[model samples]
Target: MIAQVKLAFGIAAGFGLGALTVQALHAQAGPPAYVISEITVTDADAYNREYVPLANRALAESGQRRLASGGRTVALAGEPPASRIVVSVFENLEKARAAYSSPDYLAARAIGDRYGRLRIFAVEGLAQ
Candidate 1:
């Protein structure tokens, strides 16, 4: 009887350790996120010269890295795409939003508002 009890206790301990390890791994593998922006610039020159630099600075400050940016887009499907598309990666959704909402970025965005329209979204990335 004592041997059986010891074996049961050992099994329970093993399961507990396994659960902890899985939890730790999950935490360590925190998923990344992305910020996507579709822009249609009415005043291209103003957006490029005045807004881009300031926006980049703010995004960097908030730990966002521009993954891709382009002024021209070719849509494979769906309705016509925006004139410009930009994708930025961040640690997570919160950081992405924070970057876009930060004062510096907001200021840059205001300038862009005067020159264009923006459609922005945050998306959670696949697990690493």
Candidate 2:
């Protein structure tokens, strides 16, 4: 599934971002990847106690910068959004994926699994 998503992302990049192929983009070290996570905590206490610290450590180790976190989400249209929205900026999609799957994050994630429902996605940002 992830492979398919990456393939689609590459195709979109080839056309949408102009002459820069995936290799060229990586070679030139273009824009970073932004990971957006929307979370609804079923057990706020457990999430705060068991998940936050480990996840923070993983993010720090991965050098991911938090753009926005623990922000209330407002939905102008459609159903109500998650209770909290988190956006983290990573060096690239690969880094973001690695950080998400790292042992630290995985351990934290186990706790979250019992406490919250998450919707996460990553998009390559516009070049700086």
Best prediction by TM-score: 1
After best superposition, candidate 2 residue 81: deviation in angstroms? Answer: 1.4
Q: Which tens-of-lDDT digit does each residue in 1-128 have in candidate 1?
A: 99999999999999999999999988886788988899988999998999989888878888888888985578798998888999889988877878888899899999889888999999999877
Which residue pairs does candidate 1 place in steric collision? none
Model 1 CA deviation exceeding 4 Å by range: 1-26
lDDT of 2: 0.87
Q: What is the TM-score of each candidate against the true structure?
A: 0.76, 0.74
lDDT of 1: 0.88
lDDT string, candidate 2, 1-128, tens digits: 99999999999877866755665766788679999998988999999998888788877999899999987668899998789889999988889999998988888888788989988889998877
TM-score of 2: 0.74
lDDT, residue 49, candidate 2: 90
